[model samples]
Target: MAAGEVTLDPEIALFLREMRAEWAQHPPLESLGFPEQRAVCEAVRARWAEGGPRMARTIERVFDPGAGKLHVRVYLPDGAGDPAPALVYLHGGGFTLFSIDTHDRLMREYAAAGGFAVIGVDYPLSPEHKYPVALNRIEALMLWLRTHAAELGVDPARLAIGGDSAGANLSFATALRLRDRGEEGLVSAILSNYGYFSTTVSDEAEARFGGPGSIMDRAEAVSYYANYLTDIERERSDPLACPLLADLAALPPVLLVIPECDLLTEQSLVMDARLRAAGVAAEAIVYPGTTHSFLEAMSLAAVARQGIADGARFVAGCLSR
Candidate 1:
């Protein structure tokens, strides 16, 4: 057993075991072509869509042709008044796979939990769209949100952004870009779930969290980064590509949810420290006995439920201020 490898929660262990069984039968997602990989991802998501809690009063899909036909799903929770607070979300797929449909249930959960209109952005993928392309589209979406707040039932004054994994990376990157453009006030809070902020692995984090059983291993991380940024040397230090290396002053308050047994746990720890050092309010919580992408398994993981609740509280407080 590795030094950092701890016993998984009974349910979590069972969940991993089941996934491992499936992986043994099918080629790993990374080994397949993009279309096949996406199909597999959607298939997995379909199994979990057994009528989960639905609280949104209205859900609508809108298209922005300016962002290359980018699709955004808006979820307005029940009892939400006109001009409700909004959280612009990006779905996680390591910058390659997954879509709004794969993450629909999760976005709905956040909308119901936070009492805010959650907009899920279906941005372009990498190995095709590549670096900076998705960022530009997201920035356009932010601008569109500002201009169409009233029409969309969102409060222009109270806006936030967030996502998980690759989406979280985009969320932070978008906020940084907005700050550089003197539009930082567009967002009041950030919700980052098991995000990847740095391409380089910290030795401390590697020793503490890296292991065979971890959902995202070092090789997989390297592959994802490679696909997103073809020129690692040239793009590695770019703030938009790696927020951990960015200037962290006066940004929005951040709520980070870290999964203890995951390889990317260090990103959240270092991000929290950097934000605090820069006099920014950034709170992070580590869900013990959980692994990367555990939030998607909320129906089976109590820690995930708690993490979502914590996120809801953080967003509510930030928007109310």
Candidate 2:
């Protein structure tokens, strides 16, 4: 398939093929004004407000220790054992949108497929609390998980972390922090999907891969990066601010998923290179014919749904060891 032409996934191939012509009739994001973009995002999320596969056991309103009053949702596989392997998820919305309710389905599916526990943290967004605040919330969640491993029935020792888009960025930064603090065995693997990193976009990447794919636009990346940084100097070196800039050695094995149609594919690929070069065990898979945030459209997009399966497979392999 060509760069923009994606083959549909077997599960939703027919749907995508049929909807292609209809979706082409109108651009999804163009209708939104600056104010409406937030509303549009919320409206779309409300439509899928109840996220995840229907079969998993989900528990909501859990609190984080470090960030008092912070909330998280947990997904436990049906009949999963005590102290099961766990995967903590952070939702991606360019650090602006998406709540636990928005991504419940995807988290549940991951828990069910991997037969592990899934924790979804609803961290604070940027330009309000800004970069480090969100990262701090994530790190606190990790530390809290480690502290309450017994109560939560989580094997923090066999844990994995991951997220989509902005969430994936948090996971990457958290992994780096864990490595820096000599905290190994806290996470066995990480599943990163179209994770955001780097403010330095080449004119070439911007020119070629700039368009709509699934939920977000390729052009929005520049804006997201700008908002993420409160200070330009700090942005370059804040290991917590930009994970791709941090040292990758001593981190747990990672599974990086890069979708061909997303603008962040190049950024993710660059992280993959860094992880490998630093001797971290990492496997990055690029899903052809798909765009970013594919997992959110399990009901609508075929290849997007397949990416979830791919993620589950990666998690299973990472946990097997």
Candidate 3:
């Protein structure tokens, strides 16, 4: 679809309108103070999550003793075999907000649909964890998972990594790091759902998706970046802080699910071009009429459901290949 032709799906638009109305009645999450914001995040998740499906098995709070007791949640789909394919999922919250619990329902959906185990990483957030901290932790987690895959009931060979928003950024960065370490073949695919990849916004993006009617405004974008990378110098130079600037060649096949009405659409487009230019196989699908974080409202959005299904199919295809 043409970028300019993008419009919000009626249902999604109504959802956004209702959300704005509610935020007006209550305080907007972005406008609220930090403590209140955190509390509201928890409340919002509880309200929207209809209790995810029952998995064949679920192990929560699994600790990686070698990495400061790093916690991860493992969700195994029903009828999974002895060495099921797996995906390491990172939760999106601009790198500073939300937790694995908030994203549990979506993870379960992906796990069930993709017929693979989903490992959700509860990495430390920013302002407390800062640049490269999350990246380093992700690398360590990858290593731990590789070493312990047999015990975890997953095949290390069929592993993939992905996330939405900041998590997507980390996914790309982690893949790049692994590539640099000559372990790029470990990743079978990448699932990036409307993820932000740069701290800097392009003029074309700003002209296309930024402004008054945008779901994620420029100010909010700046705030998220600031929270994640408080250090100006590092934000500019650290490849992990902005994977869009990293070497895109030699990475695994990537599936980028782009939302139609998000400022980050252009980021995905740019990355797609770079990946192709660098000889990396990449497929980018734009979900027409959707906005950023639409997957969070899967309970209310048909398009969101389709997007999740598409993601599952893409991952399954990658593993089969």
Candidate 4:
């Protein structure tokens, strides 16, 4: 928790302290099972609803071509006008917990700081829509953004998508999927916060210190991934499901933000390494003195604010390049 020489905000520091208390609070995940895990998630979401600001704007809303509607909360800063560089924003909840409202603060900050229109996709959640469900919905919205850029008042050529944790994993894959499908209008860049790429977790990963960040534990991670898959025990090699596991060739520029204290730090670092080796103009930065959900509490953490600002710049520069 001692992240470099920097001291975190008091609220975030206290929040992390509270979170640490819940680290082993819920027994072994195996004992809880899927149904019980989902119940806990529902209660968590209910509690999150009692927060955030009332002045947030609604810029774009699209009925998803798929099953559910992809309600995009558009965060356009006060001075936003003309065709601005648009960011397709996704929220992290391991495809389970968080909703757009839960991630409102971060989105608002991005729109205000970067002077970009953020299309916050309220994609479907997991253990329900699972696996490709959210990713597919994201792709559909991306295509719509490209085909109707004028309607969105955005330049399709200057588009970027990013998210935290699970959201980041999806955004990274969405970009690769766009390129693979030969879509002429693809996003110029991507950002992944505490990204989870490969499905493979080593034995040591599960044994000591736990693997990946506590936000998504080993058992929950495997179960969530399993739930997201379409088939029965048959895994798909499509990189869109796991961008880090996918070939980095022919992808656009990327910026991966990693938390020094988070367990998933290594996951993002490896993905950055692969993308750089493939010459895809990728960059990885480890933010010290923060927890997994620091990005959400940017109002309390200057480091989190800096991380989001850095990500916005990365996306903007990708389009500019």
Residue ranges of candidate 3 with Cα displaced over 4 Å: 1-6, 30-35
* Order of quality (lDDT): 1, 3, 2, 4
Better of 2 and 3 by TM-score: 3
Model 1: per-residue Cα lDDT over 38-155, one tens digit each: 8887877755444455765655656773566687878888766688998888988889888888888887778888888888888989888889889999988887778887777888
Clashes of 2: 5
- The superposed Cα distance between candidate 2 and the true structure at residue 86, in angstroms, equals 0.9
User: lDDT per residue, candidate 4, 1-321, as tens digits?
Assistant: 343234545666766665545544555545675557655544444433344333224565667644457887777665556676788888877677566776776777777767777878889876778677788888888887776866766777778889988889888878877888997357877878887676665554444325443444577666667767766245546577767668778877778888765546667878888888888888888876665667765655678778978987877667666
Top candidate on TM-score is 1
Query: Ranking under TM-score, best-scoring first?
Result: 1, 3, 2, 4
In order of appearance, the predictions have TM-scores of 0.93, 0.85, 0.92, 0.82
The TM-score of candidate 3 is 0.92
lDDT of 2 by residue, 67-163 (tens): 6557877777875567778888899878876677678778877887778888888887665667788888778778877878657667777788999
Error of 2 at 290 (Å): 1.0
> Which RMSD does model 3 reach against the true structure?
2.5
TM-score of 2: 0.85
